[model samples]
Target chain A: MSKDYNNFDYLSVSVKSDQLSRILQCYRVLGWTEVKTEDDKRYYDMSYVRLRRPHKIPNKDRLQYLQVRMESAINSLVEIVGRAHVKSTAVISVLVIIFLVCTGLAAWQFLSLNQAYSQVYGWICAVVACASALAACIAGACLRRRERRAAADKISARLKLMQSLIAEAKLLVPQPQNEEEERAGEVNNG
Target chain B: MDKSSRASHSLEDRSRRRRQRFTEDKLVKIRTEHSAGSFKTIFAALIILFQLGIIILLGTLPAFALWWYLLILAAISIITAFSVLSSHRAAQAKAVWVLFVLVFFFGGFIIYFMSNDKYMYARARRRHRAIFARSEKFLPEYAALNAAPDMKLTCSYLSRAGKFAAYNNTKLQYFPSGAQLFDDVIEKLKSARSFVFIEYYAVSDGVLLNRIWDILKQKAEEGVDVRLIYDDVGSRAFSRGMRKKMRDSGVQVKVFNRLISWFTFAMNYRDHRKIIVIDGCIAYTGGSNIADEYVNEKHMHGYWKDTGIRLEGEAVDAMTLFFLRQWEFITKKSFDYSPYFGHYQTLYSPYVVAPYVGGPEYELTICKSVFESVINSARQKLYIMTPYFIPDDSVVQSLINKALAGVDVRIILPSVPDKYYVYLVTRDNAEKLIKYGVKIYYLRDSFVHSKLVLTESCAVVGTVNFDMRSFYQQFENGILTDDKNVVAAVAADFERTFPDCDHPASAAKNGLARAVAIALLRFISPLM
Candidate 1:
C-alpha cells in the first residue's frame, strides 16, 4: 500500500484548552501546518484542529509515531491534573467531617453533664474541634495550591519531553537550503 | 491412606492429564477451524429431524396415520406451487420451480418457499422505499435537460422504476483497467472533507484496500464520517481481526445481508454493487472490488482485466443515495439526505448521465429492463463486455434479435475463468448466440471483469454483470448516459481489447459427458 508520496497527508487531533498552544507549537516543528480549528461541543475545554504535512517527509513513520506518543502524554497529564483537584476536594471533605464529629461530642458533654471534670472534657473537645476546623481551612487553601504547583511542574516536565521529541522530529522534516531545492523537495516529498 | 492407594491415584491423575492434553491438541483445535461448518450443518439437520420426530409422534396418536401426514404435505405443496405461479419471477425460472415442485413433491415446494418467502425482503424493501421516498425531495427535477430520444426514453424508464433521474451537469471519466481506477480513487479519497461512503461486494485485505484504508483511517480521525458496507459472503476472506482493526481506527463498517444471520436464510440476494461516494461530490462504481486481483497486484485468473468509471458532479448524488439506502437497510438507521446531495454548478456538457440502482426486492429487474431497452434500440453498433454471459432467456433473445437485424453486436468474455462450472455455462450460452450471428470473443489470457454495454446512442457501466444472479438476485447500480466522450472511451477500450481476444468459428465441440454436464448446469444456471 505504501508508494512514493504524491499528495499531502492530513491529520487532525484534539487537545485540551490548557495544552492546545504548546501542542500546536510543537507540531509545527514536524512540518505540520494548522489548517483550521473547531471547538468540540462535547467538552468545553477540548478543541480539535486539522493539520497537513507533506506525506514524503523524511522518516515519516518515526515522526508520526512520536506525534502519537506526544498526544498520549498530553492526555495522561490532563488526567493526572483532573485527579489532583478531586483528591483535594476529598481531603477537605474528610477534615470537615472530623470537625463536625468533634463539635457534636463537645456539645453532648456540656449539655448532659454538670461535673467540673465533664465540663473540662467538653472544653477540651471544643478546642480540639476548633483545631480541626483550622486544619481544614489550611488544607483547603495551602494544600490545594501546593498540589496545583506540583501538577504544573509535572506538566512542564512532559512539555519539555515533547519539545525534545519535536527537536528530533524536526530533523526528519526536509529543510531545503535553496528555492529550487525547496520546490524540488516539495515535489519529492509530497 | 495406604501408600499403594495414593500411588494409584497419582497414576490415574497423570493419565487423565495426558488424555486432556491430547484432546486439546488434536480434537479441539482441529474441530474448531476445519469442522465448524459441518458442526453447524449437523446441528441444523438434527433440528429438522427433531421436528420430523414430533410430527411422526403426532401421526402415531389416536386416529392419526401416514395418509394424513401425506395429505398435509400435499396441501402445503399445492399452496407453494400456486404462489410460484403467481410470483413475479421470470417465466423460465417460474417454470423450472413449478416443475421442481411437481416432480419432487415432498420437499421441493418447501425449499422453494424457504428460498423465496414473500416476507424475506420485507425489512429491506420497506427501508429502501422509505429512503427513496425521502430522497425524492433532494434530487432536483431534470426534465428540461437536452437529451437524445433514445437516452430520454431509457432514462425515464429507469426513473419511473426507482429513485434515480438524469442530470446534465455530471462529468464522466472511464478507466479501462482497475489499476487506473484505484489511482484516481486514492486521490479522490485523500481529498474527502466531509464523509466517505463505500459499498462493495468483495473487500479483501490486499494492497489496494490497504492503501485506501490508510487514507480512510486518517480521514475518519480528522472527524470525517466514514462508513463502509461490504457483503459478508463476498468478503469472506476479510478476517475478523481486520474488521476489528478498521473499527478501532474509527471506520464504521456494516455487513450487508450477513451470511451467518439467524434472522433469515435468504442468503441468495447479495449486495453486488461496488460504489464509492466521497463527500457527495465524487463517486466511483464499476466491476472492480477492493482486492489485489482488481488492481492486478496479484494475478487471480491470468491477468485480471477490470473497468471502472469516475463521476464528478451532480450524478454522484445518486451514488450517495444508493450507498445511504443500502446502509439504512442493513443498519436500520436513517439520516438526513439533504447534506449528501452534491450541489455542484458544473460547466455545461452535452452528456446526460442518469445514475440508477437495482435490487431483488423491486418488482421489476431494473438492470435487465434498461439493458433490454438499450439493446432493442441499437441502430448501428452494439458492444457488450461481461465476465459472465449467463443472462436470462429474454436478454439472450434480445441479443439474437438485434444481431439478426444486422446490428454489429459483439460480446467479449473471459478466456481464463475464475469459476470453471459457471464459465462452461457462459461458453455454452455464448455459442448459442453465435449461431444467430452475434460475435462472441474470449479475451485471450485474461478474465474480463468489466460490465459494460454500448450502443450508438448511449452506454451502460457499473457492477451489474450480464448474468442471471445480477439481473434477479443482487443489488446493482450503474450509470446510463448519452455522453459522447464517455461512450467513445468505452468503445475505444472494447476495440483495443479485441486484438487480444479469440473469435472461434464455434467453441470446440464438448465431449459427450461435458456436454451433458453443461446442459444440467444450464438448467440450474438461474440459481448459480
Candidate 2:
C-alpha cells in the first residue's frame, strides 16, 4: 500500500483582476481547491489566489506536474504577448477614408477644369495629390506605431507576471521529470 | 449585562433592524421600478397620442409659428430623454433612445432643428474636436506635448485653459488628513457671506459630520444661503434627527437623485464629488467624505488615510459652476447663480490652475483624458495613489506603454482593504504592473483614499479615482495645476506613504479565499 501524503504546501500568486478569476478557474480545473480568500487579508500585502497542488500524489510527482502545468500557463501568456503586436484598425480605416476623400476631391476638381485643362494647373494638381498622399501615409504610420506600442505594453504586463509566477513556482517545487528524479521517486517526494 | 452594555446591545439591534428595513425598502423600490418599466408600451402609446393631439389642437395657430410648436414638443421630448437617461428604470432608457433615434430619422428639418438639442453634448464634442484640432497640445497628447520646451509650456497652458477659466492667482493648500480638512471646511463655512454650497458622496452619522452640520447651521442662522446636497445611497447611514435639525436651523437640504428619481434612468450613478464651495471664493474637494473614520477618530479597518485641497482663485469659479449646475439639476430651480462668481479673486499669479468636472453627460471624459495625458507625458516618473485600480483598456494601455517607455511608474494601493473583492482586483492589476516596468507599493497599515496623479511638472488631486465608475459614470471633479508647491507636496505624500509590499517570492496562504474571490469576480467581471 502507498503511504498517504498529508503535508501539502500552497502557491500564492497575486494576479491582475482581469486575469485573477481565470487563473483561479485554472487551478480548480487542475484539481486544486478553488481559491478561497481570508476576511482580513488586504491587497497591500498582495492577494489574488492561493493555488494548491492536489493531494494523494507524491510530492515529487506533484512538483513535476505543477512545473509542467505552470510552464504551459507561462507559454500561453507568452503567446498572448507574441500576438499582442497588432495594427490599429481605426487608424487604418481613417487613413483609407482620408485618401479616398482627398483623391475624390482632386479628381472632381480636375474634371471641373477639364475644358480649361491648363498644363500649369495640371502640374499643380499632380503635386498637391502626391503631397497629400505622402503626408497621409506618414501620419498613418506614426499612429499605427503608437497604437502598436500601447498594445504591446498592455500584453507585456500580463506576460511579465506570468513569467514571475513561473519562476516563483519553480523556486517552490522541485525539478521536473529528470532522470535522477525518476530513480529517486517516492522517497524523495516524501 | 450591565445597563450600559444592554443599552449598547439594544442600539446595535436597532441599527441592524434599520439596515434590514432599508434593504427591504430598496427591494420594494426595485420591484416598483421593474413594474413601471413593464408599462412602457402603454406609456409610449399615450405619449404619441398626446403629442398628436397637441399637434392637431395647435394646428389652428399661425403657419409662421408652426416651428414653435415642434420646438416645444422637441423641448418636452428632450426633457423626457434626459429623465429616462437619469432614471433607474431600465426599460425607459432603451425606449427613450429608440424614440429619439426614430424622431431624428423621420423628422424633417423642422423637427430636427427643434430636437437637435437632445444631442447637444455629441454636437458640442464634434465642434470642439475641430476647435481642439487647432490646439494639439491637449492633455491626451503627452508625448507630443513633452517633445519640446515650447510644446510643454503650451501643454500646461492648454490644460489650464480647457472649458474653464485658467486661474493664475489661485492659492491651493493641501490637507493631508481629515482633521485638517474638516477643520478648514468648518472655518470656511463660518466665514460664509452670501452663500455656502456643500455636496458630498457620503455623509455618515459621526462627530465630524456633527461639527460640519453645526457650522452650516450657524452660517445659515447668520443668513448664509446654505445649500447642501448629499448622495441618497451613500448618506443612508445619516440619522433622520440631524437632517430635521438642519432644516429647522434653516439650511436647505436636498438629496441627489433619490430612489424615486430612479425612473429618470441615469440613476446608476451617484454624485461622488465631495465639494464645499463657500462664498464663491473658497472651495474644498478630495476623497474624504463626512465621517469620523475619515479623520481617524474611529478606525474601522486600520488607520484611514485621505487627502483634500483648498482653492482660492479662478479655480473656485469652476467649482462654483459645478455646484450651481448640480444644484439646479437636483432642485429643479432656475435661479441666477451668477452672484457666486462675483466673489472670485482678481489677483494674478504665476500658478496655472484648471478645475474641471466629468460625468456621463459629457461627450468627452475629462478625468480619463487628463490621466491619459499625464501618463503619456511622464518623462521621469508617474506617481498614482488610489484605493481601486480597476482601469479600462485605454488607461491600462497608456500606463503599460508609459512604463515600457522608460518612465518610472509607481502606484500606491491600500494594505488595509475596505472591500475584499475590489481589493482582489486591485492586487491583480498591481501584480501585472509590478511584472511590467511599474513598481507597485502598498501604503503600510493604512487605507489610503487619496485620488491623485503627479508627474514632474503637473499634479491633479480630487474626487476622481482611477476606476471605471469615476472615469465613466459618476460625477467627478478635480483640480489640475502646474504649481511647483502642489506637485512637490503630492510627491512628498507619495514618498511618505509607501506601504509595505509583499514580494511575489513569498508564499500565499488561503486558497479558499482566492478561489471564492475568483469565482465571484468571474461572474461579475464584465460589470466590474
Candidate 3:
C-alpha cells in the first residue's frame, strides 16, 4: 500500500532561487502560500522552496481537495497559455502584414527609380526607405521566432510543475476511500 | 551475400556457445557447505516468503478494521520474530533482546541509505526537467555544458555521466607515472592562493606523503584554506597525532568513516576518490594515492605504475564541487562555496572534460555506464589498465559484443598480486572473458595500480577500479575527455606497457579444483 495520504501536509523542493521565484508566482496565483525557504550549506546552487496550501485542511479529503486544486490550476494555466498563444499569433500576423506592405512599397519605389532618372534626393529617400523596411522585416521575423520559443518554454515548464504536483497528490491519495474519513471531511466543511 | 551468410553463421555459433556455457555454469554448484543446515535454510526462506504474502494480503484487504489489522500484524510479527530469532539463538540470548537490537541494528544504515537516495533523486529530477526542456533560462551554462545532443551518451539523466556538463578549452596535462604526478602536485600546492582541497583513499605516512605534508603545512601556515580528507580504512595507519598536528598548523582534517570494529561492513563504503584542487581552478585526479609505493620509492612492488591528470579550467569547478560535497559529508557543516567561484580562468584549449563521480549513496553507477559506452562505441581499439578486473555481467557481455564486432579488446592486469584473493576473482573474469575473444595480459614489470579505459574516440582516467567495489560501493571519480593528445597519451602508455606483459594460457587448461575455487570466489566478489 502507498503511504497514508495525511502524511503530506506540505511540499519542499530544491531549485535555484530564480526558479523558486517563478514557481512561487504560480503557487501564489493559485492561493498557495510560501511557508518556508531553506538553503542547505552544502548545496549552494539549490535552495529548498517549501509551500503550504491556504486555509486549514483536515486529515481526510486533503488529497481530494489538493487534486481538485491542481486540476483547476492546470486548467487555468492552459487557458492562460492559450490566450498568450493567440495573442502572439495575432501579433506575428500583424508584423507579417506590415512586412508585406513595407516590402511592396519598397518594390514600387525601386521600380519607379528604375524607370525614371529622378532627383538625387528622391533616389536617396527611396534607398533609405527600402533599407529601413528590410531592417524592420528581419527584426519582426526574429522577434516572432523568439516569442514563439518563449511561449513554448513557458507552457512546458508550467506543465512540468503541474505534473510534479499531481505526482505528490497521487502519493498522498489512498486508492480506497475511508467512509469515516469522508464523513469527517464533510463535517469540517459544514 | 556470402559475407552476410558468414556473419549469420558466426552469430548462430556464438548463441549456441553462450547457451551451452550458461547451462553448465548454472548446473555446477560448488558444494562447500555441509548438509546439516540445508533444511533449515529452505524453511527460513519459505517463512520469509510466506510472511511477505500475508502482509500483502492484509495490506490490500477491503476496509478492514484498523484495530483488528493491528492485532493480526502484532500476532504474526511476534510469532515470526520468535521463529527467526530461534535460529539465531547461537548469536543472541533472549528473543526480545534480539528483536530490540534488530530494530536499531540496521536503522542507522537504512535511514542513511534512504534519505541520501531521496535527496539525490530530488536533485536529479530537477536537473532532468531542465534537460528535458533544454531550457537555459533556469540553468544556462550548466545546461549547455551537460547537454550533449551530438554525443551518443545513452546514459540516464540520473546518472553521473548523464548529468555531467562538459567544459571546453580546458587544459588536460597527462602524467604517465607517479613521479611526474607527485612533483606537479607539489608545484600546484606551492601556487595555492585561496583554498586547497585534498582527498585520497590511501594516504600512508611515507616519503611521498611526508613531502606532501611539509608543503601542505607551509601553505596552511601561509594562510591558505587547506582541507584534507582521507579514508579511515585505507589510511588506518594515519596517526591521531598527525591529524592533530595538521589541525594545529591550521590545516583542516576530516576522516571519511569510522570503523565500529575490525570485522564489519559498517565502513564498507569508502572514499576512494583521489582529488586535489588548488585554488579551485587547478585540479588533479587519478589512480595514484599518497604513499611511497605509489611513487615507487618503497619496493612493495617494483616500479609501481599509475596515472594522474593535471586539469586546468572551468572543469575544475566540477572537481571543487565534488571535494566540497565530501567535505560537507564528513564535517556535517556547509562550507561557503562562493570563495571558490570566479577563480578559474578558462583558456583556449580544445578538450571536453566532464567529471563523473559516483558511490553507494547512489545505486546508478555512472562509472559503469561510462565503461559500457566506451566499449560499445569502440570500432578500432579498446584498451584498459587496472590492478583488479572483476567485472559484473553487463560489462562482461558488452566486452564480448565489442570483441565479436571486430574491436581490438586488450586489458592489462597485475602479475604481482597486491591482493591475492582479489586476484583470484580477477582471474575468474579473465578465464571466462578470454574465451570470448578478449585479450588479457599480465603486467610483469610491476603492479599496475592505474584505472584507465581508452577507446578510439575518448578515454577515462581516474580512481575507479575494474571491480564491483569501485562500481557499486566506493566513491569514484574520473574524467571522460575526447582530447586527442590525452587519448593518445593513454594509448601510448598502453603501447609502452604492452611489451612488459605476457598473455596467460587459455582457461581451458585450468584444473577442476582451480575452476571451482574461482567460481566460489567470484560469487562473493562484492564483499572482497
Using lDDT as the measure, the top candidate is 1
CA-lDDT, candidates in order: 0.77, 0.63, 0.65
Candidates 2 and 3, the one with greater TM-score:
3
Model 2, first chain, TM-score of 0.42
Arrange candidates by lDDT, descending: 1, 3, 2
Evaluated on CA atoms against the true complex, candidate 2 attains a DockQ of 0.01
Q: Candidate 3 iRMS, in Å? A: 30.2
List the lowest-lDDT window of 10 residues for candidate 2 chain A: A38-47
User: lDDT tens string, model 3, B420-493?
Assistant: 77887786687677877889998753678899999887888999988877877688998888788998999988
Return whichever of 1 and 3 wins on lDDT. 1
Question: Which candidate's TM-score is highest?
Answer: 1
Q: What is the lDDT of residue B118 in candidate 3?
A: 35
In model 3, where do residues sit more than 4 Å from their true spots? A1-190, B1-162, B262-266
Model 2 misplaced regions, further than 4 Å: A1-190, B1-162, B261-265, B499-516, B519-523
